[model samples]
Target chain A: MANKHYAMVIDLNTCVGCNACMAACAMENQTPVWKNSWRTYVHDLEIDPGTDHQVRRRFFPRLCNHCDNPPCMSVCPTGATHKLDNGIVLVDDELCMGCRACSMACPYDARFDVSYNDVEQGKEFYGELHHRTRPGVDKCSFCAHRVMKGLKPACVETCVGSARLFGDLNDPDDKVAKLVKTGVAKPLMAHLGTRPNVYYISEIERAR
Target chain B: MEGMFYSTQNVWTWWIAIYLFLGGLGAAAVVVSCLTNMYIKTHKELVLWGNISAFVMLSVGSLFLFVHLLDHLAVIHVLNPFGLLTKPDAWIMWGTQFIVWMMVFSMIYTLPYMLETPFWRDMPLVGTILGWFGWLGKLSLSFHKVVGWLAIINGVGTVLYTGLLLQSFPAVALWHNPGVPLLFIISAFSTAMAFLLLVLHLAIKREEDHDIKVLYERTDVILISIELLIIFVFFHFTTYGLESARHTADILWNDMGWIVGFIGFGLIVPFLIEFRGVTKGWNSATPVVLAAILVLCGGYLLRHYFMYAGSYERPYPAINSIHSQSNYNLLIE
Candidate 1:
C-alpha cells in the first residue's frame, strides 16, 4: 500500500448530538472525567438565538486537527510532540516537560495538560488498567494505536449516527478522499494555513 | 456573541508571567552591568552587586518556570542538544539555551570581582573557597573582556527570548505581534535602570557614583518615553488589526489593573518622577527611589496583564459566517 495519510470527515447532518464519541473517547483514552476534559466532544451551538428566524441547534464535534503544518510540534522545546509519516501527531510522555506551550500554540484548543494528580486519578477512574502512566500534555492521537492495528478510532467506531468517517486520504478510493476531492467537505479555518486533516460536511438547508 | 465562540487562553498563567518578568529584568541588568564595566567607568560595587542580583533573579525565575511544568523530572528533555538542532525555530529551545549559557557566562564574568572582594577574601569559608579557585580567577581576569562580551550576548538573547516566546504563539492574537518583542526589550532595559538606581541609593551610596546615577536616570527617561509611544501603537494596532486582537484589547482595557495599576501608577507615575529628577537637577534619592520601585512594579504588571489578555482566535470560521448576518448570533457551549 502507498504511504497512509489518515483523515476524518464529520457530517453535521447525520449527527444527533448523542455524545457517544465523547464517552467512548474518555473510556478508551482514560481522560480526566472528573474535570470533564475529553479527546473529542460535541459542542452544543445555538444559531441565530433570539432572532426573528427560528433558533436552530447545531452539534459540532471537535478534536485535534492533526494539521500538516502543526504549530504545536514546532513550538515544543523538547521535541515531545512529533508527527508520523502517516500524518498522526503524538506526544511522547517521557519527553514532554509539560510547559503547556503546545496547548497555547494549538488553534483547535485540542491539547490539555495531564498533571501528576490526573495520572493518579486515572488509576481509580480507569480501574487500574490505565494506560496514562505519566504527566504530560495530552491530545487526540487519532487513536494511532488502534489505527496501526487496522481498527478505527474509538470515537468513529462508537458513533451512533455513523456521522464520523475515518480513512486514508491518500487512497483515492476512500470515502474521505472522495468527499474532499469533490469539495463536499471543508476544513475549518483554512485561511490559518494549518492544513487540518479533519474536514466537516455542513448540513443541507431544507426547502421552505 | 463572539465571546461565546472565542475563549481566553488559560494555558500560560501568572507563573509564566513571573518568569518572563524576572528573566527580562535579570538579563537586562547583566547587559547594563557589563556595558558599564566595559565602556564608561568601572564601579566594582555596581558590577559585583549587579551580577549577584542578576544571578539570583534568574535562578528564582527558572525555579518558577520549573514549577510551572507538570513533569518536573522530564526537564532533562529540555536540555537535550538534539532538539535545538532539529527544531531551530523553536523559541523555547533557544530560551533554555540562552538562559543556561547566560547564567554560566555571568558567573564567570563575576568570578574575578568576587575573588577581589574583601568579604569573600576574608570570610572563613568563602576565603577558602576563593583560594581553591585562585587559578581559575586569574584565568578569568586574563580574558575578562571576552567573557564579558559572551555574557552580554547571552543576556541580550535571554531578554529577547522572553518576548519571542510569546510572539511564537500565533494562536493568541495579542501575543503574535512584532510590537510585543519591541515593547519587552524596552521595558527590560528601563526596569534594569530602575533596579540599578535602587541599588545605588540603598546599598552603595557613594558620592563618586554620581555620574553613574545621572547616566541611568537620563537613559531611563528616554526609554520610558519610547515605551509610552510603543504602548500607544500597541493599543492602536490591536484595536484595528484583527477581530481577535480587538477582543484581547477589550479585555485589557476593561481591567483596572492594566489601566490604573500599569498605565497610571506603573508608567505615568515613574516617568514623571524620573523625568523631573533628570531635567531639573533634583538630587533627592527619595523620589528617585520611589520612581524606581514603581517602574519595577510596572514592568511586572506589563507581563502579567499581557499574559492574561491573550485570547485565542475563533476555532471555526463557519461560526463567523453564520454570526455575521444582522439577525444571527452564536452561543457555543
Candidate 2:
C-alpha cells in the first residue's frame, strides 16, 4: 500500500470552543480525565478588546501536530515515540522509560505525562492495545485506529460546527489537500521547522 | 507577543535539578582524579579521594534519575542498547551508556588501591575474585596515561551531556542556550574541587599538604569568576535574541531570591573568601570549609533556578484553560 500523510485542519471561524470535540476524543481514546490529557485542547484566542462574549473571540483547537520532522520523536531516548508510515506520531508506552525528554522537546507542548503506574483507568477505557497498555508519554495518535478503518477521528465526527476535518494529504483529491492547497490553512509556528501536519483556517486577523 | 498565554506548568521539578548537579559533580571528580594521577606524582591521596567521590556521587546521581521515572520498575527499558546504536540524536541514550561505562572504569581504576587498604585486605575472598582481573589493573597502570586520558574524555562528554540535555529542549528558551554546556562544565569542575577540599579537610584532616590545598583553593576562586562572566553572557545573549528568550531573561533578572541567595551569598561570597584566603597565605580550616560548602550549594541552586525560569511562547495566549497557571493575570484589553 502507498504511504499516507494524514492531516487535520481546524476551522477557527466555525469553532465555538464548546469542547465537544475534546469530550468525544476523551471518550474515544480513553484519555486521562486529569487536567493535562493530550488528545486535544481548545485555546480561546482572545483578540477582542471588549467585554462582550459574543464578539471577536476565536477558539483554536490544538493537538499533537504529528510533524513531518517531529522533534519529540528525534529526542526520544528509547525510540518510544515514532512516526508511522501513515504520518501519525505514536508512543510505545512499553518502551517509554518515563524520561520526559520527548515532552520537553515538543514545541507545541502537546505531550502529556502518563508515566504513573496507577493509570489503569485509561487502560480500562481503551482495553488492550499492545503499545499503550502501560504508563508512558501520552499524545494524540491522530486517531490512527479509526482512520485505518476508513472512518474519521472521533473529534472530527462529533464537531458540532463541522470545524474539524481529517483526511490523507497524500491523496491529491482529498478535501484536506484541496483546502491546504488553497493557501488559507496555516500551520502554527511554521518557522519552527517541524512542518506540523495540523493546520488552522481563520477568518479573524491574528493578534500581534 | 509576551504574556499572551501563561505557560502550562511543566512536569520537571527539583529532583531533576539535583540529578543534573550531581551528574556534573561526579563527572568532574572522575576527570580531575585521572588528571591528577597522570600529571602529579605526590597527589596519590587526592586521586584516591576523587576516585571514591566519583563512584559514590555517580551512583547516587543515577539512583535519583531512576527514582524520577514515573514507573520506577521500568528502568530496564533504558538499558536496551538498540536505542544507542540506532538513534544518534538521543542524548539520553548516550548519557546512560556513558555513565554505565564511567562507573565500570571508575571501579577498575579504584580497585587496586582499595585492595591495598586495611578493609579490603581483611576480606581475602575479595582478593581471590579480583586476582583473575588483577592483570587489568596492572595493565591499566602500565598504560596509566592512556587510561587517564580516556577517563578525561568520557568525563568531559558526561558533563557536556548534562547541559546538552537541557539545550535540546528548544521550546524552553532558558534551557536551550549553548551557554548551558559551557556554564555547566565550568561549574562542575569548581564544585568538584570544592567537594575534594571539604573531604580533604574533614575526612583526611590533611592540613599538612598546604601546596595541594592552595592549588585547589586558587583554582576554585578562578572558576567562580569565570562562572559569573559566563552567566553575564548567557543573560545578554538570551535577552537580545528572541521574545521568548527575553521573557525567560526577564524572569531570571527579576528573581531576587535566586540572585541574592544563590549567586550573591553562595557563589560570590565563596569566591571572595577563597581568593582572600589564598592571597594572604592564611591556612585556616574555617575559610576553606565555608567556601567549599557555599560552592556546592550554589551549584545546586543554579540548576534549581534554571528549571524555574523555563517559559513557553504563547502565540495564541487568549485561551484560559484550567491547565494555565493562575498567577498570570489575563490581559484585560
Task: Give chain A TM for each model in order.
Answer: 0.95, 0.87
**Number of residue pairs clashing in candidate 2, backbone atoms closer than 3 angstroms, sequence gap of 3 or more or interchain:** 3
Candidate 2, residue B3: CA error in Å?
7.3
RMSD of each: 4.2, 3.5
Residue pairs with backbone overlap in model 2: A44-B319, B4-B317, B5-B317
Count of backbone clashes, every candidate in sequence = 0, 3
Candidate 1, residues B1-333: lDDT per residue as tens digits?
A: 342355565446677888999999999999999899889988778888888899899999999989888899988877776768887878989998888888888888888888988886898987898889888888888999899899999999999999999988777778887999999999999999999999999999999999999999999989988999999998898788777777777778878999899988889999999889988967579999999999999999999989877766653332210112211122122
lDDT by residue for model 2 (B1-333), tens: 632553533456577788889889988988876776667544656666887778788888888888777656667756766757777888888888777777667667766676566665466787676666677777776766766676777787888888888888777777776888888989999999899888778877765666667788989999999999998897787688777677667777778867887889778899999989888855468888988999999999898888767766755542222223542342222
**Tens digit of lDDT per residue, candidate 1, span A114-180?**
8899999888878868888889888999999999999999999999999999999999999999988
Compared with the true structure, all predictions reach lDDT values of 0.85, 0.77
Q: Write the per-residue lDDT of candidate 2 for residues A48-155, one digit (tens) a residue.
A: 555655555668788889999998988888888888988999987777877788877787768777745437665665567523457767888888889889999999
| C-alpha DockQ for predicted model 1 | 0.44
List where candidate 2 sits over 4 angstroms from the true fold: A34-36, A44-46, A50-55, A115-118, A123-132, A205-208, B123-139, B316-333
Per-residue error for B242 in candidate 2, Å, reads 2.6
| TM-scores vs. true structure, each candidate | 0.93, 0.89
C-alpha RMSD (angstroms) for model 1: 4.2
In angstroms, how far off is B236's CA in candidate 2?
A: 2.0
